[model samples]
Target chain A: MNIVVLVKQVPDSGADRNLRNDDNTVDRGSANNVINEMDEYAIEEALKIKEAHGGEVTILTMGPDRATESIRKALSMGPDKAVHVVDDALHGSCAVATSKVLAAALGQLNADLVICGAESTDGRVQVMPHMIAERLGVAALTGARKLTVDGGTLTVERQTEEGYEVITAATPAVVSVWDTINEPRYPSFKGIMAAKKKPVQTLSLADLGVAPTEVGFDGATSAVVEHSKRPPRSGGAKITDEGEGGVKLVEFLATEKFV
Target chain B: MTFDLTSEQDQLRDAVRALGRRYGHGYFVEKAKAGEHTTELWAEAGRLGYLGVNIPTAYGGGGGGITELAIVCEELAAAGCPLLLLVVSPAIAATVINRHGTEEQRKRHLPGLADGSAKIVFAITEPDAGSNFHRLGTVARRDGDGWLLSGRKCYISGVDEADHVLVVARTEDAGTGKLKPALFIVPTNAAGLTRSKLDMEIVSPENQFLLYLDDVRLPADALVGESLDAGLPALFAGLNPERITVAAMGAGTGRYAIERASGYTATRKVWGGRSIGSHQGVSHPLAHAAVQVELARLMIQKAATLYDAGRDLEAGVAGNMAKYAAGEAAALAVDTAVQALGGAGMTTEYGVATLLGAVRAGRIAPVSREMILNFVAQHVLGQDKSY
Candidate 1:
């Protein structure tokens, strides 16, 4: 089986504050690039399956030249190979534009399965994989918490607000992993060294038969219209004293609706 | 030449963090208290090539180095499942076998260690020796095509769970002008060998054991590397790896503690419904500790690289330095996380306090913080030997 994991280079969510600038765009300089958190889960899940059943894992990502860093990280995580889409126009692009570019890149690779993170940490819009599925005309599963692939049969469990929903799809489908799924793995030193030699094929929009007019920030469906800092909160009343005074607080709570 | 980790290393960091978060501190705390190993986490880590990060690819390993090994431990410890066996199994035993063991030994043990199917425990520290490695009393005498070993070892970790133990002992007759140290692979179930559990007060999943070798015999091939004549160099090979692994364990523990504290401080509410993190009282210390942890992690990577590059003594110094820094950083990070969590930190359900005792061991066992400082003072700083 051949599996392709869609890894995105995003600013580390924990360090996302560094990416903010007065212009309302992600400050590229201060932003440390990393694989999307959820996509890491997808890559880990894919590796787990490949380890159990003999297969090759191919990592796919569409971003600038630096995005290959995320792909290399995926490859180091034991992926057999990788594909990097290096187009300057993809910078500051929305999820839709990114998905369209990735779909074009992935279209050229032959794979039995494709997996992606449910949402990129930078833009939590959560629409990339679904849009990729539509573009590629493949069955799509979103928010998968658990995934198992057996002989071209795919079983996925998705977390819902109320409970969970389990769905099974055929081979050659797309899966967008949610955060609740299996924990992703850190690249071991061996993976890192070996990743240096692993094949990472690079392509541009023209290589995948994609026209320049259909890509870039203009192609993105969603854009930030306005941005502002969250106002600092006001102070609260202090509940002073203890013991008998605490009992008085309980009595006060009884008089209030909190009781 | 880049100072940052390679892309793959970055991916590994992200992946291990994600996987570790799945079970997290709550699960690890329960397992530690019950004295049960996190076999689930260990198995998953092994499958993902996280456990044997440094073992060679030909042996079913990731073909990485000590840096990967350290990353695995740091990531797992950060995720709350710091497996001491990761240090013992692949880092020490498997590494020794792969480097020095005969082809059969490497072929037999490497795959299992890499896949987590077989576990090998490392035993070197003895009660009598007590860090004075040359003073160890364990002796192996030649028998009929085998060796009869007799001695005792203390504070050996995870012997009960090991398939075999790589025991460090002296071989050949003592008074015959032939005095040298040797290593032997002793099956844990070998007859005439007895192991007793040490009732440690700490709550680590891996327990220490006292090993007694009473006329225990092993095959001739069990002696790793060269014969008794070339002892010290072979012994140091295994010992150096052990030290580097300890450093990795410290890195993992520190990462876990910092993550827990950072996550809590980032969003935890306080006065005026604002995150308590906005207050200097809470945020400043965390920031300080974060710097310390990062500094220790840098030392850990440097040590791992030197070790992987086969710079032995330099690697030793780096390992000791990294281990010392990481031990302190992990303990402080966990303690700070607990404090930052306020009331929730103390609760068993919260799981931060469990790491407190576990991280403390980094400063106490394998090698103590004082021991590391002493080593640095004497060896690196050219100070007088105090110990």
Candidate 2:
């Protein structure tokens, strides 16, 4: 099996994030860029499948040059190699454009399977796997809490609000996973050192046969006209309870519809 | 001339910091207070190759030099889990064996040291010696093809956790019939070897012990290097690495203390609406300690770089100075942190006072600040030895 995992470099969700005032895109210049949190789980899943079945695991990422840091970090988690799609024209590309570029890169690799996170922390759209799968004309197993591969068949326990639904697909499928799948491993010292020597193939829009006019802000299907800072939290109602403290708490819960 | 760590080194530091934080100070203090070792953390670090960063790659180590090892030490310490055994086992025993041990000895030991599965502690300080090698009472006498060693070592750290102890003893010179120092790898379970734990005030998981080697017999292969001539140089080989790593650990502890205090003071409001850090009385001391810690860190970097470059003579001078600065800085930082935290710092929940004993001991153990000053006075200043 030749598996491809999609990785993204995003502003750390734990820290303060902002948007550029000029075009309202993410402010990557001042932010601490790290591998998307859920993408690590995807990487772990891809590595796991490769470990059990004996295949190559390749990381596929699309972003600017700084995204190489994330690629190296993901490689240290035991991936075989990486394909980095970097182009200034790829800037401000929305989910639709991203999936198109990624699909093109995946097409060149001839991957039998592609794995990715259900949603990115920054976008949280939960649509990249489906979009890429649609573009590749392959089956997509989205929101998978558990995945099993046997021969050419793939089975997944697709997570839902109530419970999980069993889904099955053949080879040449895109599987997007939830964090419930498995725990990720820390990079070992040897892995970190070896990652420095691993091959990282860099490609641009032209290299992928992607025209400059097909991506970037000009080709983006959606645009954010304006963005603003989230309002600071205001103190909620405080009750000074006397002897009826329990009754007051019940009343407050009822008023807030939490009871 | 550049102050920046290589990208790989930076990645190493970040990785170690994350690992340390995952365990955190709470786990460390809980283990220590329960009279248990940080066995899980140590094993994980070893498995991740953090423990054997300085060991040769052929022996399953990272093959990096002391600079890499120091980063591991400092990052772990900064996360409030300083492992003293790191200074002894990897820094002292591993380096000495790799540099001066015989090829057979290296083959037998380096792999284990590199993988963190084996720990070899060093034992040289004796109750009677008091830093004076001339007064060392530990003597090894030839018996057939083997040797018998007898002596009492005081304040040896982590003997219980190690499988072997590198014993430094004096042997009779065949040519001159005079005593000279030699190193022997003695198994901790060797016959006639016994240890008694010392009650210490430090709140640390590692324990110190008084080691008694009474007629401990060992095969001739136990000796490090090809001959007795390898003894002195082998013993000296471990000193600079030991001093440099210990200093890195001290500098890390200082950084930990200052960070804790700064975090507390910045949010802890006692008067009016302003935080306690708004007052110069509380903030100035922390700032001062931070400056001192930064200075000590620079010296540690210089010393480690010089040592790794194989300039042992210059490294000795810098290592001593680095140790002295770091020891004083660590002690001061912990003290100032406690003061800044006020009543909260005295409580174990705050985690500042727990390091008081360890930092205080740092100024005295392995090599004391006064002894370092003595070395600098004689070597760097061309002054007569005071002792």
Candidate 3:
């Protein structure tokens, strides 16, 4: 079995984040960039499948040149190889456009299975697997909390508001793993060094048979018109108790309809 | 020539930093206070291959050199769970074995070191030898085909956790009629090997041991290489990485301190909701410490690069200097951080004070700051040997 994991590079989650004023996109330099945290689970899940059966794990990510960091990080988690779809023209891509380009690359690579996080922390566009699956005309399982794979069948425990639903799909399928699936393993020092030698095939929009006009901002079906920061929070009320403190608290609570 | 780490190194740093954050200072202190080891973290890190990074690829390692291992050390330290064993075990012992061990020994130890399944602690410091390898009292004399080794080593770290010890002993070279440095792989469970723990004040999961090897007989193959003569160069090879990794640990602890202080001062308001960080008094000292730490880190990078490049002589000079700079910087950084936190800094809950003794201890151990200065004074400054 050959598996490909889709990952994304996002600004450090703990760092201060800001958006570009000119457009609605995030300002990349506001902080450091790291592999999207949720994708770590995807890498872990793929590694688990490889360990259980016999197969190779390949990490697939799309972004600018620096996105290679994401690929290397995922590869460090014991992926056999990587496919980095890097191109400046790929910026400002919508989830649909991203899935199309990724599907094209997956098509070129002949991936038997594709796994990814349910949602990207940066984009929060949970439609990655749907778009990729639609494009490839393959089955997709999203929000998978538990997963198992057999010879030609893949089973997933789809998380729901009620509980969980077991879903199974045939070969050449896409699955979006939930963070609860498994704890992502830390990349060993050897894994980090060995990742340097692992093959990373870089692709561009053209290389994936994607036209420039059909990718990036122009190619997207939907785009953010504008984005703004949330207003800063104001200080809350602080009370001083000199006398009748209990009575004052009761009065205030009653006045605020809490009592 | 670029000061910035490559994209790959940056990722390694970020990943290790994340790992460190997962097991914060709280966990580290709890284990230390209970006199327990950070077994989970160590096992996880080792299993992840963070430990044997400097070992060769054929030995089931990452094929990286001291440069990568130093990064791992610093990142872990920055996360407040500094793994001191990393310095001795992988950085020193693994490098020595890789460079000087026979193929059989490498096959036995290197793969385990690479995967973190096996650990090999380093023992060179002796009660009488101190910093002087020439004065080492450990003697390994041939008894038939094997050797009888006897020595008392002090300040050996993580002996309890180690499977084997790369013992630095002195052997008489019959060919040259001279006493030269020799290395032997002594099993920690060897018949005559005994270890006693020393009480330490420093807040760390690793413990120091006083090792006594009395008439410990070893097989002829226990000697690392075929020749006992390839001693000094092999010893120096391990020392360079040791110094570099220790510097990385220092710089990392310094970073940990500065970050803690900065976080506290940024939020802890005083005098009418004004952050204390607004005062020039607290901020400048932290800033100065940050500058010094950055400078030391740059030197560490240079030293590691030189060592990785096989420029041993240049690496030796730089590694010594980097260790000196980093030791002082860590002490300074920790001190400044404590001052910035005022009373909160001393509070154990704040986690800043836990590093104080450890950072100060950094100046005196593995190799003292004075020894480094003496080296620089003699080698770089063309001065008379002070020691």
Calculate each model's fnat, 2 decimals.
Answer: 0.42, 0.58, 0.83
Better of 2 and 3 by DockQ: 2
Q: Sorted on lDDT, highest at the top, how do the candidates line up?
A: 2, 3, 1
For this target, which candidate reaches the highest TM-score against the unseen true structure? 2
Lowest-sum lDDT 10-residue window in model 2 chain B = B1-10
Q: Give the per-residue lDDT digits (tens) of candidate 3, residues B1-387.
A: 544677667767777888989998899999999999998888887777677777887888877778888998999899998899889888988888889888899999999988778889999999898888889999999999999999899999999989999999989889887889989999999999999998888998889999999999999999988788677777877899999999999999999999999998988887897898988898999999999999999999999998888889999999999999999999999999989988888999999899988998999988998898899989999999976
lDDT score, candidate 1, position B57: 85
Which structure is stronger by lDDT: 2 or 3? 2
Q: Please report how far candidate 1 places residue B46 from its true position, in Å.
A: 1.5
Candidate number with the higher TM-score (2 or 3): 2
DockQ of every predicted complex: 0.29, 0.73, 0.64
Off by over 4 Å in 2: A242-252
**Could you tell me every candidate's TM-score relative to the true structure?**
0.78, 0.97, 0.90
TM-score of chain B of each: 0.93, 0.99, 0.98
Tell me how much of the true interface, by contacts, candidate 2 captures: 0.58
Residue B60, candidate 2: Cα error in Å is: 0.8
Q: What CAPRI grade goes to candidate 2?
A: medium
Q: Sorted on TM-score, highest at the top, how do the candidates line up?
A: 2, 3, 1
Q: Enumerate residue pairs that collide in model 2.
A: none
